[model samples]
Target: MDIDKIRNSAGSMKIADLKEGDQITGMVTVGEDLYMIANNSVHQIKLADSIDPKRIDPTVPNLQQKIFGKGSDSILVSRTMIFAHEICKGDVFEDSFNKEKIMNISIDLLRCVIDMDECFNIIKLYNKDAMSSVDDRRSVDLSMKLPSLGEKAINGETFFRKLSMSYLLILRTFWAAHNKEVDKIFDRTLDFVSKNYRDDERFIKFIQQLVEFSRMFKDWRNLIEHPKRGEYFKIIDYTYAGNNKISRPMFEVVSKKYPQEPVDLEVNMEKLIDLTISNYESLLCFLCERKLKEIAGYTFKVMEIPLKMRRYPHVRYGIALPTTKGPAPLG
Candidate 1:
């Protein structure tokens, strides 16, 4: 019997083929009364004296027991056996393992990126050391003191201008971290602006606005990292500057431009924490993808050491299981 044919036919044999008296060379089906021959033949196999006795010493652990044992040695040995069995069965273990590892890494990277982005945003809105901080604080403070809608409107415009700067900074930082060709892109953008719109006041104004926004975002990030004592309160005040000026059109414009509403100091702080977590998750996804790509290129290196080398059954089985179990059942 050809070994390859027997291996391929192991799963498709009949119970009659596995009875006592038949000669077989392939794997025995556990709990199934079936026997497969090396040449893909089905036959009943007798229990001959030549067959090794299925003896078990109480002290000597079985494969399952050894794999789940307290000692690492036993566990490792069991894992190796399982892995070898899986390979013999034609399982694509290496590819599957690498795919999972890469996914995890990419998720982590994305989370980090998002965290950094939100951190920069929060700092820009509140921190005094951020670019446009002086103008933002002045506008907010002035708006708070005014009773008329018109005065508040004027203040809101200034505040919105400041908020736009924060958005610019966020975009800049995100590009810096993720875009390898950002420098070239920036150079091209500047050249395009100079050649086509340099003489246009609106175009120049747009460029200036974008620059300020980016600067504000970056400055805010710096202040958060190196904060001084009254800094937090000051930042909060600036963020909620037009809270009471809801009737003013300028305030509406600011709200539209930077939709982040500051809650009570404590509540707003919690929101920041939530934003941080959200950002972290986003960055993790990016990182996980990046890592997966890297892993894909080094698949052989990552899975080079065969599971058999470690001799651990649990390791092999665990690797076969899904990384995360599905959601729990509802009551």
Candidate 2:
């Protein structure tokens, strides 16, 4: 409730101090329970089972309230932390370096999602209320210009690129553990997977889907990073084509894979976000299934926060073993 926000040389901050676009560092284990540590202090993390709004102190900022209160898309944030924990199990990364790499990547991925989700929410909110004012329906210029594409903007194209880069980096690191030659480049990684992991049909299919998914955003991602002539994000403003229609604010990015077709930035971004999350879930399940015998005695537990207060990640999970004996079955 009265979570102290302390700034340190390492730039670590607690989950309570987490703003809409703030990035999480890494989580730590304090005894058997999990706590997110800042520079010198550890914040008590509320699992879904323990998250109660009524008990929330008024000292918590409104930003965190939106994130950790009700209807916050924070479950994904929690899932990312849990994902890192679970991913580190069962011989994925043999060394501490790779495991720490996984942790860093997962934390950054969580931040990317936090920024992306908030940007998407803003765009959706503006569009939903666009009809409220005539000017609202008019095209709005994002703060970013073509010359410097790196300037932070609360838009789909920017955050989408962020998410893609992080995902690809994680994929490379993840696969490299299995095959040391895998590179961070997406195409090269795909080539490696295609040739080496071809025996596994599910993995191959996933890689294929991932390739296609990456391609969907490839042109725009590249354009943002390395723009070519005549390639630009059509700002969510007036629909210049139709008969003077006030269009819903959205970005229009042409796919190099589908140059002739028109793509809705918002719609595609939503789909991409869902696909990204599912891909992670699939990867985790794939690994667990691959070692069923080793993990047979463990149970995956998801402690979910109430749906209303799920904005900031409240879910905590782990592969748990039964520690208490139940009554023997009566015969």
RMSD (Cα, Å) for all candidates, in order, is 23.6, 12.0
lDDT of 1 by residue, 1-331 (tens): 4433333343432333233444333332322222232222323333221132332222221111111111212222222222222222222232323332222222233233333334444433433233222232455564333222323223222332333332433233333233323444334444544675555666445545444444444444433345444332122233334444322111111122233333433233335334433332332223222223222333211122234543332433221212234221111
Local accuracy of candidate 2 as per-residue lDDT tens digits, 1-331: 3332211113432356544654444455422334553332224454322333453444432221222221223456545645555444544222422444455556556666666677677666655654444442234653211111122234756676766765674465445345344544668767876887778977888877776666656665777677667666454553434554444545666544534245555676677676676676555445443433333454433232233433234332233333354211111
Among all windows of 10 consecutive residues in model 1, the one with the lowest summed lDDT is 61-70
lDDT values of the candidates? 0.31, 0.50
Report the alpha-carbon TM-score of model 2 versus the true structure.
Answer: 0.58
Off by over 4 Å in 2: 1-73, 87-98, 135-154, 176-184, 240-246, 258-260, 291-331
Distance (Å) between predicted and true CA of 149, model 2?
17
